[model samples]
Target: MTGWRRRETKREEQIIRVLQEPPEAIDLRGARRWRWADEHWRVWLRRSATGVELFTRWQESDEYRYMLGDDAYQMQLIEILTRATPRDCAAAGFGCTRRMDRACSEPSICSRDPLPAAGVDPHREGPVPGGCDSFYGGDDVRVRFSAGNRHQAVRWSMSLWIDGVRVGAGLRLASSGWWLDDRFFVVPAEGPDEHPAQEYTMGDLVSVIHSVLIHDAALSVTRVLVPGPEEMWTEPWVVRDGDELRVYPDQETSRGPDRTIVLTD
Candidate 1:
C-alpha cells in the first residue's frame, strides 16, 4: 500500500539563474580533483592539466560548475590544495557577493540583485567577513550580518551595506535581521554581555530578554528599550499602528516604553 499524501498548495515559482558557459581557457577534461566538504559549503577544484581550469561549488548549487577564468583564483585554489587540511579550507579566502548555498536553494534566487563582476567591491572595501549567517535583500541594497553566537561574549565584526558602502562601521553582537524596505532594516538584537543576576525574579541568564535595533538609509541607528525591563523579558509583539510599526513589551499590554519605530520614508 502507498503512504498517505497531502495536497500541494499553489505557490509562486522562482526563477533560477543559469551560470554562463565556461571559456575555452578552462578545459575540464583530465583535471585533478581536490575536494573539501563542510557544513555550509561543499567545495572542490578541477585543476587543468595544461591550463587554468578551477571550479568552485561554493559560488552556487551543486548542479552547475562555476569557474573563474582569472589565473589569480586558480593559484589561490592550488595553494589551498597543497596544504590539504581542514584548517586551510576554513581559512581560504574565496570572495563573491554570495556563497550561494545555505538558506536559499539557488544563489540567483537568494540574491535579489545582479552580482557585481568578479573581485569587485560590491559591499565595502578590503575582504568580506567570515562566517556570514544569512543574506537579506540584494547586492544593491542589502543587509549581511552574522547571528547565533549566543555562547560567545564577543563575535566577529559585522555591518550592513548599501550600494557598495558600509553602514555604521560594524557591530560585534550577533543578531537576526529583516530588510523591511530599501532604507530600513530591523533586528531582534541580542542584549549586552553582562546582565546582573539580582535584577530579575528568575535571575539574569534564566530570564528571557528582548530588544530591537533599527537602521535607516542615512546610517542612523535607533535602538528600542535595549536590554528591556527587569523581569519583563517576554517576547514583544509587533503591530501595525497607522503608518508606523509599534512593538509592545508583551502581548498583555500596549503600554510600556513605546518601542515605536517610524516607518515613513
Candidate 2:
C-alpha cells in the first residue's frame, strides 16, 4: 500500500482546475501553471478562454491525442511542432530505437571476444589477457568526448548530440546502451544555415557518423564523449578504425596511467 499522499497546494488545485474547466483569457494572463509530462501522457498546459486547457499525447503513437474542452492548457499551433515531429527510426537494426533522454548507462557492460562461439553469454567478467571483455561501473553519469567528422558517440548537459544533431537517450547496442538522457549537444553549422538538432536512433547515429566521416570530411568530432562499453570510466578506448566503427572493450580508463583522461561515473 502507498503511504499517505501529500495534500495538493493551492497552486496545484489551480493547475488541476485549469485542466478540467478552463478559465477565461483574463484568468490565463494571471494564472501560472507548470507543464505536466510523464512516460504515459506527455501532458501540457496552455492559455485558453479565461483560464487554461489540458492536452496530452501518447509517446508510442503519434495519431493519438486527448483534449478536454474549449478552454485549453496546451501550446498553440506554433509550439506544437516539437510534439508533432515523428521519431526517426529508419536505421534501427538488431536493436531497439530509443529517445536519447531515456537511455540507461548501466555500469556493467557485457563484452565478448570479437568473434565468440555461437551461444556464450558476453558477460564473462575477466578477459583472457588479450581477448574480448565486459566491464562494470556506477549508473547515472555523462561522458564527454572531443570528436570530429570521423565521428564518435556524443553527449551534453540535457541533450544527446550525434554528428551535430540531437538524439534520444537510447543508443542501444547488443546488450545495453548509454544513459545520455538530459545530456546536451550542438549541431555544426553547414553552409549558410545552422543545423537543427533532433533525436536519432542507434542505427541513425551509426549512419550519421558514417556519413560525416565519408562526406563531411571537413568536420571533426570536436569535444566528443566517446561511447565506451558499459564498463567504461576514464578508460582509454582501443578504437579500431575500419569500414565499421569498433570500440574495443578495455578497462584502461580506470587503471590506465595518469596521462589518460580520468572521469567518474
TM-score of 1: 0.35
lDDT of each: 0.34, 0.24
Off by over 4 Å in 1: 1-25, 29-172, 192-207, 218-224, 227-233, 236-240, 250-257, 261-265
Worst 10 residues of 1 by lDDT: 146-155
Across 9-79, the per-residue lDDT of candidate 2 in tens digits comes to 65678878889985568755434222222121111112111111112221212233234322231223112
**RMSD after CA superposition, every candidate:** 18.2, 19.9
Question: What TM-score against the true fold does each predicted structure earn?
Answer: 0.35, 0.19
lDDT of 1 by residue, 202-232 (tens): 4222334555555553345454446533534
